[model samples]
Target: MKTNRGGGDEALKFSSFFFMPERPRDYLVLFIRFSVIACLVVSVSLVLRATFLSSSPRDYSTTYGLRFTTVPQKSIALSPTGSIGPLNVSHILFCIAGAAETWIDRSQYTSLWWRNSTTRGFVWLDKPVNLPQNHSDVRFSIPIRVSDPGWTRFKFSSSRAAVRIARIIWDSYRLNLPDVRWFVMGDDDTVFFTENLVKVLSKYDHEQMWYIGGNSESVEQDVMHAYDMAFGGGGFAISHPLAARLANAMDGCLQRYFYFYGSDQRIAACVSEIGVPFTEERGFHQLDIKGDPYVYLSAHPLTPLVSLHHLVYLDPMFPNKNPIESLQNLMKPYSLDQNRILQQINCHEGKRQWSISISWGYSIQIYSYFLTAKELTTPLQTFKTWRSSSDGPFVFNTRSLPPDPCQRPVTYFMDGAEDVRFYGTKTRYSVADKNFGLCENNTEHSELTKVKRILVTSMKMDPEYWNKAPRRQCCEVMEGGRGKRKENEMLIRIRKCKSSERI
Candidate 1:
């Protein structure tokens, strides 16, 4: 019993020491240590969350819906040590020309628009002259010489200014500039989105002799140049190999076409002899308007802007009053949305009643002015463009005709038992000829609202339905068929009920 009691005492002594209360200083130290460890753990967790999980910068494309992109544009996979971004454009030599008086304005434009460029700018003057401060280096005086053909016909003459200019400029930089890949030509007043231009050139192999340019603006100009000439003021690019060939032949070739009028035509004629064709690109603006016209640049032209010509006379191209600021504004929305920018819509349920505007990838938004879908009795201007100072180049013009879908350029129509059919085309508006003026014609609603314009025949109706019921064939109508033309075609049309007869 005494030995058992001794063991119990030893146990009690061990328990008493283990359960003793800590002092205030010791307890405070323990709490501080716990708080420090907790703070460290939380700080580390927050740092890890921020580093591993965060949204990236906004994509430059003005996409309004699901941006289904395959990979980053202008991005190249690089080795661990290399950097990647927009392509470098050192291989291109920019050769620009202008008359003596406009050098100052052109130089200012060149500095801003083609800033930080790997370019050699040349301004060809009409006579020997002293240039402004920074302009002396790139400017060259007239009587610009090239190898003469040594004959009167082929020789550069006073009357044929274009021939002389082309021979001198095109030949001057041949083989001498060995390292360059392309020679891009433009007037000093021409403004270029240099980055987009670089990207456009990168797509093609510079080794292949390439001649790329844009077409003339109007039908009259087309008739004059016969659409063969590249509008020179708009700017054009020549690959190294072609430039070499042109340098060799242009002097002799210019002697042949004494009748040619402008520099562009003469250059076009020379190239025609050389057999390198003009690859047309859309971004080049060749003409100046009578007044300030912002629609050409701002209204979503299908191509990326390469250059704009004749900016001096026209109204400013951008929101700002300054021309340099206007030039920079050309890069907005990086790329044009080609697919379904304007959908070919039939006058079905939603389309006819309200206005449906489908902008690029963004979903369709329907705007309805009336409470109920009814015929617009009053003559409402279907399209009108308001030129408010605030609204820049983008006015929703339901008034502008769907600029495409030109059928056979003729006018003829035939009527079937149930519907009227237009064989080819006449005036833009689709209408059944009545004793008086014409009203909304078929499903096409041709000139009605510029929104969704399509002919009745294009609605994917069954061929048999047209043939057997009130029916006849179309494309074949003009060709030949057993069914004679429907003389009474305009008489019968099964149209929807009109709202009111009082008007």
Candidate 2:
């Protein structure tokens, strides 16, 4: 009875307050305040819901029974205080896989292109090696970093080195280097044409995930491995964001893919788990061949020459020189015009009834007889497969050398190159002193043999040329070519073809 009276009193007070009439102005103000409060509560609830949904993990399942769990995108930590304007030699970090045993011989290949203070990265070695007292040479440009020891703990099939090498991507990312957009991995013997490499990499957005490189040239090797796998010796680039993701997952991935034969395959497998596919840039030459690389290097694809590998297995690029010497000779012209190195251009000298093929910065061939464009472009079958020395099944087409020596063209190797004015270059090619039977009865053959040296003039190829759809530049025999010049000399010019000009 006492509790009922107290409850009744409270109810009566609430009812009186609810029913009490107020001024019209006061009522309007009350309604407005109520509405505003309601709106604020609803707005706050909506904002909290949106934030939670965005930050939380979500599952997207398809009708086909496949499910994908996606998390929020994480922002990458860039060490550069200022904005990275454009990709350059410094923007790339090279993580070279090296061993103490072979470093002495193979280190020369790395030195060939590695710039002392400009290029970034380290030669990751199994163990440290003694250095020469005179370490001032460009050959010692790259500093060495010995890998952490626990790489042997991972289960491996063929070689334990695969585990250590595959972990390079992980170890390199852990360094937390500054302003590194791309991490380029390669074998110690791999030689990179860095200028051309920078040109190719600039085309891609480094902020996004990119795994760019080339596959094996041999179909057998591709079949033995994976067609989509980037051959490591050719060198491959992993963008910053992708490298971070790979590094986080590399230890677990290495444990899972331990049975893979090669380190490249292990890397490919880990990359696949991250859902980034292998992107092929044809300029990366794995050089998966036996015998000679002359014909292959001569007829380069319509792209920038980025890298070359497996030089130790193949014959020297130029005759009468060792492998390193040949590369040094090639590098001289490469330094002059890297974009135009080994770029092919063929033209017909209609008056002399001759066909001329130019592998710029490398070699040139002059034919007394006329040959079709297809015949000139196709690489001669001068190489075999990597694993098996078989003739069939290369990635690209090849043509056999003509059985008749008479049909063969006289060959010339690059002697020297000099800048001609500001915009152009003049590369000289001296006839190689090799004995071959000439087309004896033909007048064109006799006249061509007397021509000893050929001078090629062309505008310096802009590095920006590779950014567009590649079209081979057309060439023409200069006017008064054989008439006004010395009997032992020839001149030619390479230029862009006009809209109506046909090859």
Candidate 3:
């Protein structure tokens, strides 16, 4: 009975050992598993927090709206050359009226308005002043001028003008109850294309970029060359921060320098000093006496933005004759009176024998062509083909003179072989016979032979054939085989010769 009881107790002890954990090792294993799971959960939480929850904040105070305004000098008298005689007032009035119309049209897209002060008998003030209400984003600020006679000098004029415009711009910002992103300074004669300007500005939203009117070129100090900086009086735009900087800069300058070259140069110098760079756009161009004026026009067909100091009036009589007149004639189709406008500007009665000189590239040979036709005629019928020596010149076999007395004399030289190389002597033509000398003692003959040899070699004829080939035949061969192997071989030989000579 004792042995059987002992066996049952042993069996019970063995079963308990199998079912329960009795060692420290087992507890340590369980603790390590729970610790690893807890560590993984903590690491995942930290990663999510860093990636999705904790990010740098964004700025919300930056301005987005843009405003445009014109700054006209009312206190200062017009330049001596600015006079249009009896039509001075009429011209100024017409410019103001045209500007007003453009402003009204542009106001549809953004805030467009005139920024000027009251002056004595200024025709610009006489125009209808109605600010558009539809553009909630746009507003106008026409500040009253506080006349100060002492502020009439070049430096003072620019500084004071900047201050006044800046104040008006700031006031507009306050009244409109919105943050203004950009402020554009333009001329009264400028016709703004608000849509295009807006499209261009949208590209550089956060970047503080200045869009200067006209082409900007680096000029030397001593040279009295045409100003290449952004003409503030013509058209230019400044970012919100830049506008503030400019205003502050101007104010600082007003307290110091009393002599500078007006507002445009002053602004240019000031901005340059501050290390603020400008981005140029063709949207703003100076109305000039050269180039295609219509290409510079912001509002196509009729109105051009920012007619500089020169192109204030359109000459009616010589509409297509001169720069200003040509611009007027080009805009005639869009003007109110087609024929009467020209007559009003004295287009029909003018008999002035104006000298017209046509320039061919960088050459000095100015071909003078006169027109006896009625003034304002485009003279499309009298058009002359532009010839260049590099472009293989104009070939005129017949020695017929042009109808106009002012036309330059073009003497046609012929090669009896009918393989003549026609060149325009117009560029290098000398009016003085003394400048040209006849071939003396066969010096030109040697040169002619050398040129002929070069021509034969360039034509890539066999060495034997080139030695005996006629000049006309060589020329004929070259003309026929333009893009052939002969042309390439000739080019290669020329390059090799030049390189060898250099070496």
Tell me each candidate's RMSD, in Å, in order: 21.1, 8.7, 20.8
Cand. 2 Cα-lDDT: 0.85
What digit string (tens of lDDT, one per residue) describes model 3 on residues 1-503? 88999999898876654444578786776677668979999999999988875475433332222222223333211111111112111111111211344444432212222223311111122125566574344224332222223333424533445433323322222222223455555544543434234434544442354635553211221122234466543466665555545554554555454445344555566677677765665445443322222211211111122323223332221212553343433232212212111111001111222221111111011112233322211212111222111211111111222344334321111111111134211111112111112333443222221211112111122223212421211011122335443422111011112222211
> Residue pairs in steric clash, candidate 1?
154-255, 383-399, 415-489
- Cα error of candidate 1 at position 311, Å: 1.7
Tens-place lDDT per residue, model 2, 333-449, is 888888999999988998877988899999998888898888888887788999998995899999887777667788898989888777788899989843445467767677888
The full ranking of all candidates by lDDT, starting with the best, is: 2, 1, 3
Q: Write down the TM-score for model 2.
A: 0.82
CA-lDDT, candidates in order: 0.45, 0.85, 0.32
TM-score of 1: 0.47
- Whole-model lDDT, model 3: 0.32
In model 1, the worst 10-residue window by lDDT is 408-417
Count clashes in each candidate, considering only residues at least 3 apart in sequence or on different chains: 3, 0, 4
lDDT of 2 at 325: 90
